[model samples]
Target: MGSHWSAASRARALASATRLWRGSLSQPLLTWALVLLTVVASVAVVTTGNWVPVSVLILIELLGAFLLRLRGMVVLCSVIAAECVGMVVARSEAFNPGEMLVQGVSIVALLAFAFHREQLGLQGAPGGLMLVDLRDRLAAHGRIPRLPAPWRVDSALRAAYAEAFSGDFVVASTAERGTLLEVAVVDVSGKGQAAGVRSLLLSGSFGGLLGAMPPEEFLPAANDYLLAQDWDEGFATAIHVSVDLSTGEYWIVSAGHPPAVQLHAGSGRLDIIDSIGAPALGVVSDLRCVPVTGRLLPGDTLMLYTDGVIEVPGHDVEMGIDRLMGAAERMLSTGRGGAEAVLAAVRASEGDDRALVLVHRDQS
Candidate 1:
């Protein structure tokens, strides 16, 4: 009963969110609704000298704008709405021709500007929808495998920025013969939109690269592509790993990115597989990415991450690494060490993008 109630509640919340999201996407309807509400509420409130309704309407407009990130429409609507509400609240029934004229002009100008902004793409893409698409791409759902049943791979990523686009890990996964699995975690250099766009552009190609070639060649090809672009100050760090599910043989390639950490199933020992490669991609040409071999026996877990997990300000990288190892040990011992759990163990710094991937060999 408890689970059923919880499920119902979640469904309602999702429905509400979906409606609100759809409303924001309907530009014509949203814009006209705001305009009509503001105009009607303003005129009614002013004529009746009742400010309460107008005030409430303004609050609703503000709430919608805040929730939807509709900056332009909200700003204009609030200004006009407040003007109407204030006139009524002040008990000024005498309609000042000048004041009314100014607001009328303001409303028209605002609507024109809003329409122009939309047409010119000055308003930018809606963050909510863009984030949804980005989240799906970052995870690469259909491309990743959850094979052999109960034994599964789990991953999570978080961006510090509100837009949810970041320079964190770019993930791509594939399985061969339903037994061999390959995954890559790449970190594009830089942050915010510049890095976000580059990461998006590279993620597609990298996804194909990870699936099309051997683990060792992934980084070399990635480096070649980056060098080809010849960007003045852009590079990327990455780790690519391929695993034989049946035999537990794993081959890893690192390109100036942090290593993959593994936990020994029998001894509860932790090992960090550091990156042994040339500088990060784009730094130089003809880069050779050395493959690191390891084994994941049943019950063992392997972890991959972006530098944002470590490299905390005022703290050395080694301390951050040690923090992760210690956290992983405790969580794994308690059967709570999932990808997100380990990431939470190491508190993130403000304005840093982070990502983590975990592959656990289920106990037989």
Candidate 2:
């Protein structure tokens, strides 16, 4: 009986140790362990005839800026102390004043950077990680769902200055058990990073509203949402499209956005869709949006785009539209590259964010 009890006790102890070991691998604890190891390495380097360069210790502390939070100060101090020890142990001829000055300047520069980063209310590299997470979430919200084989959809966005974040975004959904496709193309007021925060927030809200309620209700609800924010530069333009995949019936709703273009495969003609009209979102209260109805027969293509694709300095929007239409005609006729090619061919300037959404009904 005693032997059995002893075996059970051993098993419990082993489990506890395993848990403790795993727990020690978490943050702050892991950082502390790294600090301790750095200190040990510093000592070993100094005592072992200073074989390793002191610059190596400085490099470790520099890396700590990205990995450590408030603990980075401890690493800085430890490395400075290690350098001092190395200087003392080295032969008198080996102590170069120029090298020491350079090291001191590098350490001071690192300290200044750390203080600046702290003032921004960020710890380590969390700001960058947070931005990455935001970008991914926005992209996820914009991702188009898989559609039936007869229909194909593609979208592209380019931020002003080639930034990672854009003012323009596309969010899509399939409802009615995959018989309907709903896509919303939006362009927030500002460009690139200046509008990235607002863009991310609206993308999430708009994605939720799309396909969650009736198609006609999306823009009015989105307008109400934007009005609630009451921001000075809060207005935005958008095009919401709801299509019946099986029947080729569709509705186009515009909120002060540039018109959508439709390609009639049978006639080989392009028609600009600008019938539906409403104020830009957040511009007015009690907003009501009426959609323009249309049909997309087999081999037909519908294109939606933001103003950035057409607008340029010293030119009216009409001219830009004409240019876009010509490019679209060429692209549709050849059937070569997809949305990216059309955007590349039609964009007037890189001064603003551009986005394009193309929906094509395959030839039957």
Candidate 3:
């Protein structure tokens, strides 16, 4: 009876988490996948007339705590508790008291990796980036009007992310009808006032050309703005995208930037969106942005970021891209939804100045 009750309780809790996060990604799909796998293993404790697998489930749950913040913790405990209860009730012939005790200690040890506090002392901060809270001061320019009547963008971080001013401005824009016009996510090379200035000039030129110029000419317009500047402080990497929301089709031109990854929601497969184009902005006058086109369905997401997310001291660019692709594939199998969850997983493992912008359509 006790073991049966335990299984019932564990099943209930897992069901709740599944229902709550059904619509969107609540955690990294990897973590969720592990949780499900372990839960299935625990259920086997009852049917197989064995409880040995529960020990394995506990270890997997503990490892999960490292990948995700709080959800991992909850799922780990729920599985252990469910097994404990079910063992008492179903009184499965497979239940081994000695092994269960050992597994319990191991589970505690695994959870230790995710925590700062131990009986002896505290752990080092896990996240490595020296990030600034660009919240109060660096507001997205919602009040200001950017041309291109269809898209709404304000110059919020034009100074820093654009290059001239660090944490100086923000361009928060949206378009009701972005059928023909292009949208871009760009990254300045690195830190300092010079990078800030470069970011600003890039943002200014792009803002100016958004409504009028053809998508291909926008980067050149930005380059013209970069050359007009008297100072030669820094360069930037960028991806300019022309997306047709109506048809879920997009044309992307890569300019010496990290490749973007596209996740098709209907089929959790990914396409590496990469092409050889011009050098980073501000360096070349006649840079070319090689374009690639693809179609997306509702819930499909594409992510573009700088080198910060997967940088290696060695030029293991191919390896880095592969790791990111593997992570995305793992996330999809767990049934977690959306781009933000994917970004969170990448950031959790990142050791640099990570920035990501995702484009996903509303499913309504």
Name the top TM-score candidate: 2
lDDT of 1 by residue, 1-364 (tens): 4443343454455556666656656655555666666677666765665443444454444434433234547564666656665764665655565655555555555556556655544442343444455545644522456567435777767776644677775555666767778878877888765677677778877877776776677888988888887777679888888888888888888888888899887899999986656678888787887778988988888888888888788988888888888888988857975878878888767477787888788888
How do all models score by TM-score?
Answer: 0.71, 0.79, 0.50
Order candidates by lDDT, high to low: 2, 1, 3
**Top candidate by lDDT:** 2
Q: Write the per-residue lDDT of candidate 3 for residues 1-364, one digit (tens) a residue.
A: 5443343454455455445544353455756677677667766766676435656765676556544555456566666766666665776466677766877777666666555333322221222110111121122321233333222221112232333234122232334544553566667665535354455555555665664667778777766666567455556666777766567787877767788788777777888876546787778778777788987677666666556555566758777777666666666446464444554555423333445555555344
User: Stretches of candidate 2 above 4 Å error?
Assistant: 1-54, 74-130
Worst 10 residues of 2 by lDDT: 2-11
Candidate 2 per-residue lDDT, tens place, 43-79, comes to 6655665476556657766776665655555565565
Query: lDDT of all predictions, in order shown?
Result: 0.70, 0.81, 0.56
Clashes of 2: 0
CA RMSD for every model?
6.7, 9.2, 18.3
Task: Report residue 16 deviation for candidate 3 (angstroms).
Answer: 51
Q: How high is the lDDT of residue 45 in model 2?
A: 55
